[model samples]
Target chain A: MMETTTSLSFTEDGFEAFAAGREEPQWLSDLRNAAWKKFSELPWPARNDEEWIRTDIRQFKLDRYSLALEPLTSEATATALMRDGVELGGGCTSFDGRKVDSFLKDKWAEKGVVFGSFGDVIRSHGDLIQPYLLRRAVNPNYDKFAALHTAFMTGGTILYIPRGIVVDEPFHALSTLSNGSADFGHTLVILEDGAEATMLSETASEDVDGGGLHCGAIELVLNPGAHLRYVNLQNWGSNVWHFAHQKAVVDRDASLQWTIAAMGAKVAKVNQHVGLIGEGANCQVNGVMFTEGKQHLSYHTLQHHEAPNCRSDFLYKAGLQDKSRTVWRGMIKVDPIAQRTDGYQRNDNLLLSAAARADSIPGLEIEADDVRCTHGSTSGRVDDELIFYAQCRGYTRKEAIQMIVTGFFQKVFDRISIESVREALGLAIARRVREYE
Target chain B: MIDTLVIRDLHVSVEGKPILRGVTLTMNRGETHAMMGPNGSGKSTLGLAIMGHPNYEVTEGSIELNGEDLVEMSPDQRARAGMFLAFQRPIAIPGVKLADFLRHATTNVRRPDRKEGEELIPMRDFRKELKGNMEQLQMDVEFARRYVNDGFSGGEMKRAEILQLAMLQPKFAILDETDSGLDADAVRLASESIAEIGREKMGLLIITHHDKLLVHNPPEFTHVMLGGRLVETGGIELANELHSEGYDRIRKAYPEADAQNQAMLEKEDAQPVG
Candidate 1:
C-alpha cells in the first residue's frame, strides 16, 4: 500500500493505524505510508524560502496535534458548536467524525447529487471516489503543509454532480474541530461535463476557551465544459492554528471561480493552486482577508496555463488593522505549448492603522512568446480622496472609512454567481466591519 | 435684512497663495448674482471657499447664511444648511451607483420631521423622478444606473450636476463655471433649468466669463472680480460692457492703483449699485 507523509508523527501513525485496521487496498495504504515518510523527511519552511519568507511558522508544533477520534457529547451540542464562530445556511450538514447532525443527505441524494460526509462517500460510492482519492492538483513538494495534509486527512464532503445537472441553490458543508483536539478533513468535488453547481465550505473550532489546530485538504476536478463555483470562509477561533491545501483542475472549455474569505485565526497558511489544462478554459480567483489583534494570514496562489487559448485572472485584497499582518505571493505561469494564453494577477492591500502591515508579491513566468501576461501588487493605506468624498456626503470620518472598506470588498461579492451566497457573505463582511468600529 | 447667502470681506488662499482678497457679495431669496472674470481671476476660488471645501482656507473675513456663520461649518454641514456648489469639473466616483447616491444625499439633507412624515422614496418613485430629471437634461435613462459621473461626456457631466441640483433643491447654489464647457444649445438649456430652479425660492450665484448666460437669464446684480477682490458692482449692463471692451481696457484704467480697483472703475461706467 502507498501511504502519504505528514509533519506530525502522531497524526501519521494514527492514519496508518486506521488504514491497517480497516485492511484497505494495498495501493491506498502504500500511498498513505509514502506520504507519511515524505512528511517526516521534508524540512520545515524557513524564513529564507521565497514562499514562506513573509510568514513565520516556527511557533506551530505539528507533532503535538493528532487526528480527533472521540465522539462529541451529543448531536445538539455538536450542532451548537459547529454553528458558533461561523455562519451556515440551507441544506447544511455538521459532523464530528461519529454522527451527522442536521443532515439533508436524502433530499440532496434524491436529486442525483451526492452531498455527504467523507466517511459516507467512502462507504457508499467507493468506486467513484477511488480514482480521485489523494490526487492533488497542487504539487506535494510545494510546502510542508501540503505534505502534512496528504498523510492525515480523515473526514470531509464529496460533491458529485452528474452530467447536465444544474443546482440552483448552494449546498454548505461545515467541519467542526472538537475541543482540545486536532482535525484533518478532506473535500472532494467532481463536476461531470455540462454540470453547474456551487459549494460553500466553512472550517471553525468547537472550543472558544482556547486554541486548537485544523489541517485539511480539498481537491476539485472539472470535466470538459463544467462550471463550478467554490467559496471557502475560514473563521476559526482566535486561538486556533489552520493550514489548508486546496486545488482545482479545469478541463477543456470548463470554467471555475474560487473565492476565499479569511477572517479569524491566530496563525493560518493556505496554498491554492489552479491548473487550466485544456483549451478555452477560464478561471477567476478572488479573495478578501481581514486580520486584526496580532493575527497573521499567509496566502500562496498559482495560476498555471498548460493548454492553448486559456485565460486566468486573480485578484486578492486584504485589510490589516491593529497590529495584524498579511502576506500574499501569487504567480502566473504560461507554458510554451499554451500559445495565445491570457493571464493577469493583482494583489491590493489596505492598511487601516499605523501598526498594521501587509506584503504583496505578484510574479509572472511566461514561456510562450505569443502569450499576454501581466502582474502587479500594491500595499498602502486607504485613499484620502475617497474618504473625503464620502464625508462630504454626510458620513463621518469613521463611517466613511468603513463604507470605503465595505465598497472595496463589494467588488469580490459582485463576481459571485450565486445570489444567496453573495448575500450571506455580504452580511458577514458587514458585521466584521462593524466589529472594527 | 437677512439673505440666503452673504459673503463679507472674504479672503481665501490655495497652497499658501492668496486667491480671494477680501471679496464681498450677497444674494437674497429669489435673487440672481452674476460674477464675471477672465481665467485665474479668482472666480472659481470664491465658489470653492464659499462651499467650505477643505483645500481652500479662509485666512481672513467671514461667510454667513441667513444670519448664521458659514466659515466654521464642514462641507456637509453647510450643505445641510441649504448650500450647494456645482463643480466646474465634477469628480467621478466609480462603483457607487448614481441612484443610490442621490437617495442618500437627499435623505441626509431632508428635515427630520419631514423625513419621518414620508417614507424613504420608493425605488419606483425615485426611478421615475430620476427619469424626469434626466429627460429635462436630455440624458438617457441608462446614465442613472452607471457609477456616478463615471465616463460621462463633457456635456453629460454638466447636465448631471444640474440634475442633482434639481433633485436636492438647495436654497442657495454656487454654479461655478457651469457654462464654460457647454455648447450654445446646452448653455441655453442649462440657463433655462437654472431659471426654473430659481423660481423655487433658491438663490443663484452664477459665475462665468461669457455674457451669453446673462443674456439668456439676466441677473439682478453683476459683479466684476479681478486680483481676488470684487472690484465693481452694478446692474446687468456691467457684463455687456466687459464683453464689448475686454479686460485689457480694465487693466489699463487701473495701472496706477491695483488691477482689482481699476477693473471696478471700468465696470462703474454701467448703472451703479448703492
Candidate 2:
C-alpha cells in the first residue's frame, strides 16, 4: 500500500471500521484497503492536468460533506422513476449509496437472470460474478475519484444474464440522494456468451437546496457473441456535485450500445470508456445533455480498438442556455495490432444564450496503419431562418426556440432503440430548456 | 372583422436601408390581387412587411388585419390574426418534419376560435388531411417525412411553401415570387392548386414578375410597383404590357427612380438570394 499525507474524513480508520461494521468479505475488504491507500496517495486533479484542463473545480471542497450510512428513499422516488411506463425484466433501487430494494420478474428470474444488491449477490452468487468484477473492464485505480469510489462502495447493485438467455425487456436501477451527503455506489453487469440484455440506470436527487457529492462507477462485461444495451440517465439536483467513472469491455463478435443523458447537476464530471477487445466486435456510444442556470458539466470518453476489424462510433450533442457551460473531450484509440478498425465521433453544441459556452475536443491516437478514423465538432446557435420559419407558423418566440432545439437533437434521438423512454427523456430535456425563460 | 386587410402609407427598411416607400393596398375577401414588379422593386418587401418580419422595420405605416393593428404584434401574433407569407426562397431547417411543424402551427393559429378544453385535431385525422392536401399540391406524401425544405429542389421548396399555404389556410395569403424557379408545367400545376385553395374566401396577394402564372389564374386587378412605391394599377393587360415591353415604359415614366428600379432589378436577378 502507498503512503498518504493529508487526513480526510474518509480515512483508513474510517474505512476499516465501516467495512468491519458491514461484515464485508475478505476480498472486498482487501480491495477497499488497497483502494484507500491509492486514493490517499493520489492528489485531486488540478486545472493544469490535461484531462481537467477545460474544467476548473477548485471551489469544490470534499471536507464539506459526510458519507450517508443508510438508505434515504421514499415512495415518491420509486413512482417517479417508473413513470415512463417502460417494460422491465427487473428493477433495483438505492438511496444514498444504500440498497433499498430489488426484484426480478418471475420469468427472468426463472431464466437465470440475477439482479440483487452487492452484499446479497456476493454472498449468493459471488463465484458466478467474481471473474468479471475487477479483473478486465474497469479498474478502481484508473483515477483518483475512481479509487475513492472503490474505497467507499457499499450496497451497489449487480446484474448477471446467464449464457444463451435473452431478456425481452430492459432492467431498471435508480439511485437517489435525499440531502447534503456523499454517496459512492458501484454497478456491475455481466452478459455471458450469446446472451442479450438491456439495462437503464438513473440517478436523481430531489432537494436542490443542500449541496451534495456523488462519486460512482459502473462496469459492463460482455462475453463473445453477446449483446448488451446500457443507458444512464442522470438528473441530480442543481446543488449536487457528481463524479462517475464508467467503462465496458466487449469480446469477440459482441455488440454493445450505450446511451447517456446528462440533464441535471450544477457541477458534474464523468469519464466513460469502452473497449472493443476482440475481432469483429462493434460498439456505439451516444450522449445528450442540456444545461442552464450556471451549471457546469464535463464529459470525457474513449473508444479503444484492441483487435482487428472492430467498429466504434460515437455522437454527443448538448444544448446550453443561461450561464451554463459544458466540455466534451473524446478520443479514438487503436492498438498496433488492431488493423482495419473503423471509428467515427462527432459532437454538436447549440448555445441559446450568449453567456453559455461549449468546448468540444476530439482526439485520435492510432498506432495502426490501415484504420479508418474521423471526427467532427460544431458549436453555434440555430439558423436564424429556422426561428423565422417557425415563427411564421404562429409559434411564439419561446415556443419557436424550443422546437428548434428539439429538432437540433433529433439525430441523436433517432438513434435511441428504447421506444418507451424516448419521449420521457425528451420531455425532461424540454423542461430544462423551458427553464431558460 | 376578418373580411379585410389594410396596409396604409407603408414605408419599410432592412438594416436601415429603405426597401419599401409609401405604399398602400387593400384586400377584401373574394378578391385576388397581384403585386407585379421587376426584381428588387420591393414586391417581396411588401409581402414580408405585412407579415411583420423582424428584419424589415415598418418605419412609417400601419398594417391592420380586420381592424387589429399588426405592427404592434409579433410575426406569430400577426399569423394568429390570420396572415401568411409564402417565402420567395423557403429556408432549409434539418430534422424538422413538415407534418409535425404544420400540426403545431395549425394548433396555435386555430386555437383562437377554439372553445376552452377543445383539443387540437387528433393525429389520425391530421394525417389524413395532410395527405389529402399533399396530393392536391402534386407533392408525394413522402415529402412530409423529409426535413422542412432541407435538400429539396427549387421547385420542391416552392411546392412546400404552397403546401403550407394550403395547410394553414390563413385569411390573407401572400405568394411571394412563387413561380420564379418552376417550369411551365409546374407553374400551371401550382397555379391550379392556388386557385383551388384561394377560391372566393381567402384573399390572395400573388406577388410575381412573370405573367405565365397570371395566365393560368389571372387576378382581378394587377398593381405595378417601381422604386419602392406603387406606380400603376390595371387589369391583366398591365401584366402583358410589362412582360412584352420589358418595364422600359415605367422606367421612362419615372425617369430617375423607375430607371434605378430597373437597374437594381437586373443586378438582383444576376445574383440570386444568398
Candidate 3:
C-alpha cells in the first residue's frame, strides 16, 4: 500500500514546495503563485449559486484527497478506450497525475509537430507556449475549482502544430487516477494558421469504483484558418468528484468539431464554452452522456458568437438509469456585430428508470438582427411501446432496453468522425445497462 | 414434433374494457387462416393477447403453442417459441436500423437458448440472407440502412413488416391488417411476396379487410369475428362471399352479436382521436 502524502494538501507551504520541486521556468512558477493566491482568495461555490443550485457538493470533503508527491504504481490499470485498433501519431499515458509513458512518431516531429506531457513540454518550450498558456481560452479565475486547477495542475498532454502543418493521424492521451488521490491535469493545444490536428483524450481510474478528486482544465487555441477535431471521454470511477473548465477559441475561417462523452463520476460539474472570435469561423459540438447508479453530472455549455457571419451548432443527448441524474444548461449568445450568425442548440434526455431525473434548460441571447438562432430541449421516459416492439422481436427485456437506450444516443454518435471512439462508447454504455423494468 | 397453436376460449381485456370475450381457434403448420372483422371487433386484440402484450390482460383461458402454455411467458419468450405478430400500426424506433434489428431478432429466434451479449450470426452470412429477403420483397437494399419505420411511408412500413416476417420465419405468424393503407399495385406485390415467403411454410393468421392479399395465398379456413367472438367459420368460399358482399347479411342474421358489435363500435367512436 502506498503511504498517504498529506503534506501536499492545499496550503501556502504546499503550493510553494510543489512549484519548487517541479523546477519549471520562473515565469510559469510566478503564474502558479498568482493562481494559488487567487485560489486562496476565492470562496467555495454556495448551494444557492445558479450553477450549483442543481448540483449539490456539500458532502465533498477536499481534505480526504491529497496530491501524490511520489509516483504510485497500481496492479490494475484501465486499458485505453480510444486507442483500440487506432493508428496514432503519438500517445501519452499518466497515472495519479504523474507522467509514466509518452511517444511520438518521428515523421510528425520532423514536420514540427510537438506532442508529449504538458509538464515536460512547458518546461522545455516555455518561450513557445508562454503566449497561449492560461491566457487566451480558459479563464483561471472563473470559479474556485478553475483557480485550484490552474494552481496545482500537473501531468497532462500538450500538442503544438506549426503553421501550415496538418497531420492526418490522431494523438491519444489517457489519465488514470488511483484511490484517494487527486488529478489536476491541464491540457493545452495550439494550432497556427492553416494548421490542423485531432486530439483524443480520456480519463479513467485504476479501480472502476475507486474514489478520488479531479479538477482539470483544457484550452484549445486555434489561429486563423486552423481546423481541429477534439474528442474527450470522461470515464473516472464512480466515487470520483470531477470539476472541469474547458474552452476553445476559433479564429478567422477556422472550424472545430468537438465531441464529448461523459459516462462516469459520482458528482461532476463541467463548464464547456466556445468563442467564435473571427469572421467565418464555425463550430459543431456533439455531447453524449450516460449515467447509472447515484451519479450526478451537470454540464453548462456556451456558444458565444463574438464575430460576424459565424455559425455554431450544439447537440447534447443523455441517458439516465438507476437513481442517476443529469443537468444540461446550454446557451447560444450572438453579439450585436455577429449578424448573419446561424446558431442552434438542442438537448434530449432519455430516462431509463422512474426514479432517475434530468433537467434540460436551453436558452438564447441574440443581439444580431440578421442572425437565426433556435434552441430546443426534451426530457421524457423511454416509450413503453418502443420497448414492447423490440421485445416482441425476440429481445429480452434487458436487451430491449439496452438497444433502445443505444438508439437514443445514436444521433449524437453519428456526428463523431472517429470509429474507435464511437465503438468504445457504444460498448461502454451497453455494459452499464441493466433491466430497467 | 409439435407444430400447433391452440387457443381455448381465450378472454382478454385492455385496462378494464373487455376486448376479446371468448376466442377459440386452432391452427397447424402449413395452413393459412383468414380472420375477417370490422373495426372495433377486437381482431387486433386477439393477436396482441396471443403475443402476451402487457396491456392486454388475459383474464381467463390459455394460449398454447406446441403443448406449452404461452400465457405464462413474456412476449420475448413467446417470440422465441416461434410465434410472430405483424402489427397494423407498427411503432417507430428512431435510431435503430432495420437491418440491425432484424439481425438480432433472427439470431435470438434461431438460437433461443443463447445468452445476452453472445455473438450474433456471422455478418457476411446475415448480410447475404438479409439482401436476398429484401430483394424478394422488392425493396431497395438502402431500406435496410434506414431507421426502423421512422419517417417511412405507410406502404414502406408494411413492406418492412413483410421483410421481418420473411427473415424470422416463425412457426406461427399473425399479420394484422397487412394490406391496409396500400395502393393496388403495392397490395398485389405484398400479396405475392407473402405467398412466396410464407405459404405452406408456416401457419398464417392473416387479418385484413380486402381480398387482394388473399388472392395469392388462399386461406384453408376463414373465421368471421363479431362482438369479440368468431360468429362464423367456413372455407375459402366464405372469404370470397365476404369480399364480394359486405357483412350486412351476417350482421342481420346474428342480431344479438350485431347489437354487441354496434355497442362496441359506438364506444370506440366516442373516444377522442389521438
Error of 1 at A66 (Å): 6.3
- Tens digits of per-residue lDDT for model 1 on B16-43? 6566788888888778888887655677
Candidates in descending lDDT order: 3, 2, 1
| Tens-digit per-residue lDDT, A167-209, candidate 3 | 9999999999887788889999999999999999999988889
> What is the lDDT for B34 in model 1?
89
Query: Which candidate ranks first by TM-score, i.e. highest?
Result: 3
The residue-level lDDT of candidate 3 at A381 comes to 90
* Model 1 docking category: incorrect
Model 1 per-residue lDDT at A215: 74
What value does the interface RMSD of model 1 take? 3.3
Task: For candidate 1, give fnat to 2 decimals.
Answer: 0.17
Give the CA lDDT, 0 to 100, for residue B93 in model 3.
91
In model 3 chain A, which range of ten residues has the least summed lDDT? A1-10
Each prediction's number of clashing residue pairs: 20, 0, 0
Residue pairs whose backbone atoms clash in candidate 2: none
Q: Candidate 2 on A134-205: residue-level lDDT in tens?
A: 667888898888888888876567999999999978888887776665668788999999999999888887
lDDT (C-alpha, whole model) for all candidates: 0.73, 0.82, 0.90
